[model samples]
Target: MSRTLQSGYHRPRMLRHVGRFSPVRIQSMHYQSGRHIRLLLQPGRSLYDALVRPLQAIGVTSASTTILGGHFDHLEYCVAPPDPSGKAVIAYSSPIDAGASFMVFGNATLGKDMEGRPLVHCHASVRVEDGSVKGGHIVPQASIIGATPISVLVTALEGFELRQAFDDETNIPLLKPFKES
Candidate 1:
């Protein structure tokens, strides 16, 4: 409907995967309610352990968490770019270190990996040790919390679970909601 389209100009090629597109793009499930918890990421713990251990202790296996602004002794992140191998639409790049970073903001999801292990997928904007501001997918396992505890608000999903499974449409493993098993 834009001037380009109305003028019959061809659009540029869209970013897409090589796999067959699935009809169900938005996968969803219902839950009666969610438990809210105020979690503190203890200092010196890996972001993954800090986020996963406490939640796991409380019987929360799946959640959406808001990570409050704070600092980290070390941080690493990865950007997603076009896959050279063409195995999927895009792939995460190798971890990039953002040393002694200050997390401006972040959000994370706790789920189970394809192998049924805990997975913490997080994205954040941070000010690195060099004072440059950047944002990308945070590498929780490698990032260490700073001296002070960082707070997080957790909304624990009930009656269902989030699990990573292979998606044919994008030819990647993705987290999706499924009935509790």
Candidate 2:
């Protein structure tokens, strides 16, 4: 069943996860300071490479980045819906192409995957080629930057690193802060 507002706006249905809910909904850590970097997303590169390569070159593997409004030659995204297989609360839908789109805005968290590779978790609102605006979890690896450069404001996390770890509460992997080893 879908949720609809009185105004006729449709909202996604909430799913019941197959795990115990943690009492601590907000898991966070404090940092002394973060180094801010103004980055330019290079044209003709996948969003993942454009955001990861430059930051990695400067020794910034963990950060919170704000991607300014920009255009993309190609873009894809996924929405989270109830997991039909019941593995978890929700699973990402297959990539939905938003051909030659405009990214209205986005926020991305930089971290390490389970294999210690750079992982970018991004969510954004975009205007698809059809002129309909949609929002979802961005498929960075599939999205290609446009001909012009896109700007990003990055806050590099220091003294600690973000790493993906198994979360028993959600029965899925999630990014968590860990002391730099």
How well does each candidate superpose onto the true structure, as a TM-score? Answer: 0.92, 0.90
Worst 10 residues of 1 by lDDT: 1-10
lDDT of 1: 0.94
Q: Write the per-residue lDDT of candidate 1 for residues 58-80, one digit (tens) a residue.
A: 89999999999999999999999
RMSD of each: 3.7, 3.3
Off by over 4 Å in 1: 1-13
Top TM-score hit: 1
lDDT of each: 0.94, 0.94
Clash count list over all predictions: 0, 0
Shift in Å, residue 141, candidate 1: 0.5
Clashes of 2: 0
